[model samples]
Target: MTTSAPPNPSGEDESPAAGTSTTAATSTTRRTTTVTSKVPTVTAAPTSPTTPPATQVTTSTSAAPATEIPDAPGPLSPAARLEEVGTATVDGDELVVVAPSDTARADARQGLAALEIWLNGGDPGSTWTTFAATDPTSDGWRWAAVNRRTGAVVYIR
Candidate 1:
């Protein structure tokens, strides 16, 4: 007697036993999509020329008469011929003074020392070995040299 295999319940094709030949079926599907866009249009109306508003001028009789203003003063005179002889650094800034003679240089050094002493909250009167100008408007370093024999004094800044 001969027997055969049972049918597949999943509905899929099954291969023949051993070297037997078999055939399969294939299907294909295709689809296409399209997109559309719309742009807006703008229009402007014609413009006409416009006139400015009228202005009114009034005069006053109570104003004061104009006076001539004095001209500004000219630049200061340049310091007299001098050469750099000594320098002092204060608050990270170097202060320099020029002199024409060794005595003036010594005076400049004394002035710088006095300035440093004053900056440190000390009395600088004793440090001054020569006459120092007493100009009220002057700031920074000021030095002067006095002639011991003739009593002549020269000031340099």
Candidate 2:
């Protein structure tokens, strides 16, 4: 009886040829695989356009009536009074006149009068006098005098 081996699973011959070298044979198999994933879809809410409120305006056609304005009044000047206080005999002479303690306004008026005279080229020596006067409008007393020869008015601060 003769015995034989089963066929090779790789489909290659197990026996070698006489007087020839033999090499090993290799085989390869390829296979394809697939993968899957699931995801959810999203939806957004819809919006409508809005409208603005209406407005009303009024217009005038006829012109307005004219009005008249009155003229403004002029400035008021203070009234001045003069009275002789004393006299000087010659140039460089001093004439002192003291104002009554109670009559500052009178003193101021006399001083102003002397100043006016000096300003008008009157001899300073003749106009020289010491006196204090107050503004008719205010209570503050001011000292003033005239130069003996030059007629320059001097005010004491």
Candidate 3:
């Protein structure tokens, strides 16, 4: 979901369709941030928005190389970009992921990786469909998604 013309490779046209691969993008109707669908020849630029904040980055270190990926594909697929997560809570005034109690335990990026791995193997059972979580106070809550088939709660904020 996007809300306006997304910022692309700094100064390039913000056209949703103008995006190449690598750079992160948001929908024009909602604030859903994600990456383009393909890997670009050029290394993608850093800095894409998330539910936590617009400037937050999950870096390993100051020298760690940065990567830019596109949005996750349809349901049951490994999320290339975190935005592929379907929203959990829908009643809030602002859009954000509402983490569940287990959010802290299974929330490292590795969990996201695991979910991706599971998805990559082809969502085997029908136990998990998809779901979102709710935080008590964080404005709009954080964006959280759940596996309906396995009862797995993966926090993608």
Q: For this target, which candidate reaches the highest TM-score against the unseen true structure? A: 1
What ranking of all candidate models by TM-score puts the best one first? 1, 3, 2
> Candidate 1 vs. truth: CA RMSD?
20.1
Model 3 has an lDDT value of 0.38
* Per-prediction TM-score: 0.30, 0.18, 0.18
lDDT by residue (tens digit), candidate 1, 1-157: 2233344454444534523324332432222234466776666777888976687677878867543221211121254455565665556767664444432433555555655555445666743434434552352225443333322223336
Q: Give the TM-score of candidate 1.
A: 0.30
What's the distance in Å from true for residue 56, model 3? 64
**Candidate 1 segments exceeding 4 Å error:** 1-77, 100-107, 125-157
Separately for all candidates shown, the number of backbone clashes (residues 3 or more apart, or on different chains) is 0, 3, 24
Candidate 2: worst-modelled 10 consecutive residues by lDDT: 68-77
Backbone steric clashes in candidate 3, count? 24
* lDDT leader: 1
lDDT of each: 0.44, 0.40, 0.38
